[model samples]
Target: MGSEKIRRWESGALAHAATDPFGPGPVPWLRGSELHFDDTGHVVPWYVSPAAPPGPRPATSPATTPRPTAGGPRSADDVHRQIKGFASTGAVTPGEAIDFHITVDPPQRFGVDIYRIGHYGGDGAGRITTSPRLSGIVQPAPLTADRTVSCHHWWLSWRLRVPSYWNIGAYVAVLTTDDGHRSHIPFTVRDDHPADLLLLLPDITWQAYNLYPEDGRTGASLHHAWDENGRLLGEADAATTVSFDRPYAGPGLPLHVGHAYDFIRWAERYGYDLAYADARDLHAGRIDPTRYRGLVFPGHDEYWSTSMRRAVDVAREQGTSLVFLSANTMYWQVELAPSPSGVPNRLLTCRKRRGPGRSALWREADRPEQEVLGIQYAGRVPEARPLVVRNADHWLWEATGAHEGDELEGLVAGEADRYFPRAALPEHQGRILLSHSPYRDAQGAVRYQETSLYRAHSGALVFAAGTFAWSPALDRPGHVDPRVQRATANLLDRICKRD
Candidate 1:
């Protein structure tokens, strides 16, 4: 009944949305009447727009990949002039060789250069590796676009091994041609070194929400609310499975932009001893949480595999601290399968149908996310709202001098999480409920967004900010709240010492 109403409501919205005032692009508010319009009358959804305008961008060394601007690639003409390519995998361990599939228009010879993202020089230092290992120019294979997916992955042009000296962090490879054209392919280099903190990149969530359709034909994503042509899709009409062989349509890919980079810039600037891994690392048992004192989830991490959830549960029991700095985490239950060529964790499967089958919602699967997160996804807050502090006496708020009922400006924008009833919880004192902000849900019902924290019997500490915008508030010039920064630092400092 709920699905039927949503479908019918969406149909009526589409009829009216066809005449969007902005024009024929993606109807930003096609999901419902909820939308945020900017000064120019353009739809600027909170999820896409950052709460704070970022500070000066890091400097790109002449030897490394050129960074993409806030505004995406200039035009089709501009893309052709710049070399574009993708790595075989999203991440690679140190000393492991990865293949690069390159496409150079007019079929030219291109070279590859690599750089690790860090604050080596300072806050604005983008690519820290001043001298990167450069590869010789090799002629690329003839350009041939994939028939099923309209992407030019011409051929495997170069295979490069990451040196042992390369630091573990986000790395970008610059593909440069003789004509001075340059494009970047970003990937993470995982580190096995024992560290106090483990930052898990939500690459799985990044790929699940990627709707990079081929030639504008079929839309692909785990989300079931909308179809490819900007029309509302019924519960069973959405794509159940999506492949990882396609390039991300969004600017500089999905996770590399707003949420993940915000945390990266702030964490690196503070000189935290951090290690990196993809979300799949948790599922594959590659991440032994016992080795690290804390695990950090930075962005919109929505999907979770059963194995990954169990791993985190055990980590908490074993006294490894955990922090979720974003909202809508562990809300969807997805399965990982091998690609056509047998690459593990290459395909994400999420059949969102209700009852007796593969249901995407963990709530319906008899495994509520609140069992671990302490809060479940409530809904999205279309417009920005201030995060009202409720537990100012908590240690997380130390040194910030925040008082109860004080509101942090626009820190609760985008999707939010709320404490929900659950069957099981570790025996402890009443959880420290943090922020409580009121917002209207999709049904136009008034609800309060909640951020929470607690400690298990094993002495493991867990913290959830309950909003997707928390990371962005850490370092953005205008959006940076001293309270938010101080709170995060307090937690990090305490977690490391607790180890």
Candidate 2:
């Protein structure tokens, strides 16, 4: 956009193009938006112009902690930057491509006032200028559902021109509904860089949750992860960034940008290579597993799609390492049913199966494709009690520069009540890095604890903190252990630099 566009400032945003980004157009106004950089005028999406310099990040804090903890480093894919990969529902290559759709729960009333979608990046403490990548007026479309299904839903697709040069990263289609509702779906842009990964996900074996169903153990979905009743109430609006103010219910529908943000902070505190892929983009060949030395599962990566599993396996076989720092890893099976907005019924919950009389909220199709891949939760109990660190000398320990009294970060990221014994550990022979001792749940009931290890394969490196979705909670100030951070960073470095 050159002289054709003008920037406008609203109550909280700097909008470009005097008009709404999504103007009145036909269904799927699928055309690339004309794009030219403000500084160079040479439009390209290859590298974040100015490029990133090596070394530690600048000292700073995000302007707001919206939820908890303090300033932390932000991931490049931290829901910020301009949205990419939503253009074609299929594989895409470099070229001038335009707009992508934001799938929402209920279709939003179209218009442009101040709709917020995806990660809204603002100036943080580093004195870094606000990232100027993503900010546009959203154009609304008619309320409709997937052509295949007759569900009452909505989707908002905005046009974006892929600069002559584009690179790989997690991107999504976010919808800021008219009623102020919002949801994020996955999308991807091809990597211009040749494959840097060495780990062969396919070559290695996939493991189920740490504490799988051990014969007769019990497990819980860990669904009600609330400190109190008050925590469970809230509503999310794609039209706005600030949520957690309204009253609402639980699971699958609730939104928490803060949770994403919190993980980023913990990521910064612990020095994690900021990486993320929208829950929606795992498939559609969005995650080019070959480009990375390793892939990391964000905590609470409970949702899984066929493409996601396949992507991970390929990376592992290629000698790329994988760090599943999440509990409930691929606990549910889901698919992207075309939506005008927020991804709905993507989880394929039991409720959908009953068609009416169904009672269970979760479903079989909801579980990760572990059975076929070689790993699946062994028990029905999804919940895990607070566990005591059991194994202290496992190889993942090389990451912990700690003494006997030292503590490693702990998270409830994993929720295994019991696990199946492997006929074999890693081929090279692996050991349990850690275990939960004296583990008990919120009700003070004893639950089975799980163990973690560095799998026995050239590409298979397993590091599990055995925590729930909010593992960062354990990484706060005095509660956070440097050993955890160091261990995590070391793992990332090893993977990224694998020869």
lDDT of 2: 0.33
Mind giving the per-residue lDDT tens digits that candidate 2 earns over 1-499? Answer: 2465321110001111111111111101011222223222334221111122322233224431111112221111111211111233322344645344433333234321111112223211111111222333322322211111111222324555545544333233332333332222323344345443321111000111110011011111112111122132111100101111111111011222222333444444443344344444445554566566666553445545566667766656666666655344555443444333443322121122333542222234333333222233333223423434454454444646544434333333235422335422334334454654344555756555454545535555645444543334423222345556555565666666632
What lDDT tens digits, residue by residue, belong to model 1 across residues 1-499?
3433232222212211221111111101111123333333344432222322323223334532243333321211112323555667878888998777655566555555565655444332244332233333323432222212223334566788878877888766655555544445668889789999999988888777654431233434554334456464443555666766655532224542446666777888888889998898888988798788999998889889999999998898888988999888998898998866787877777766644665678888788888887888888886778899987988888789899999998888778898876544445444778888898876888888889888877788888889877887776434668899899999999999943
Local error of candidate 1 at residue 408 (angstroms): 0.2
Q: If scored against the real structure, what TM-score would every candidate get?
A: 0.78, 0.50
After superposition, candidate 2 runs with Cα above 4 Å error: 1-158, 162-276, 336-387, 399-410, 413-418, 422-428, 456-458, 469-479
> In model 2, where is the ten-residue run with the lowest total lDDT?
203-212
Q: After superposition, how far is residue 179 of candidate 2 from its true place, in Å?
A: 14
Measured with C-alpha atoms, the lDDT of residue 224 in candidate 2 is 15
Superposed by TM-score, candidate 1 places the C-alpha of residue 272 at a distance from the truth, in angstroms, of 1.2
- lDDT at 289, model 2: 62
